[model samples]
Target: MPLGRAGAPVDWLVVGLGNPGAEYVGTRHNVGFAVAGVLADRWSLPKPKSRYRGLVSEGRTGPGGPRVALLLPQTHMNDAGASVG
Candidate 1:
């Protein structure tokens, strides 16, 4: 449950914002989710799970890769604070 924070020990913080559910898939609004998926696949990371009021996937780039977390907020576009907070 490592989140991105200023002056923290995180290598990088990648955030992908989008609506939840299968219905929004492929739509322009869901580009964030799509990008996150691509990154996860490219990095061979595990499936995202529920966390921080959103779906989160945590993994390293490789055996000794830098730590990273992929976050997709389930809340609406306007109320993304819940996920970040």
Candidate 2:
């Protein structure tokens, strides 16, 4: 994935804080996840994978030439990084 030229190579990992399950998927606290979804759509990205209590996505967010691999980690609000891998 290429999120446009970063001018410099950057390994970006965008984390969306939220709890597990469908119940908490759309609460106010999960706005990060919602925004991340918009970003994914705007960038023509695909759905993420689910595992370890979180949804993960890997893709770019920019035009041609060169881009960056943007990561969306939809982990719970607390201990979000616990399931990172």
Candidate 3:
């Protein structure tokens, strides 16, 4: 991994809290997921891929931008910490 000119690792960790699977999609409890999706679009991020025990998308804040890693845990919301760790 490369560090940005900011002098440290310039990265963003955007985590969306929600239950796994289709039944949870668009539900009120998953608002964070919705927000993350919006951010991914706004940032022109790649679609989510399975990694780090979650679904992830990678993007940059702008051209020559800071790195961003958007994460949606596959575990239940209550277990999000496991995926994060």
Which candidate leads the pack in TM-score?
3
User: If scored against the real structure, what TM-score would every candidate get?
Assistant: 0.82, 0.63, 0.83
TM-score of candidate 1 on Cα atoms, chains taken together: 0.82
CA lDDT of each prediction against the hidden true structure: 0.80, 0.59, 0.80
Write one digit per residue (lDDT tens) for candidate 1, span 17-70: 888778888899899888989999988978788888898777777788898888
Clashes of each: 0, 7, 0
lDDT of 1 at 15: 81
Q: Report the lDDT tens digits of candidate 2 across residue range 1-85.
A: 2322333453565666556668876798778777777777787766676644566555556655233344445556666667655
lDDT of 3 by residue, 1-85 (tens): 3322334453778888888888988898888889988899999988788877888887697799779878898889889998877
Count residue pairs with overlapping backbones in model 1.
0
lDDT of 1: 0.80
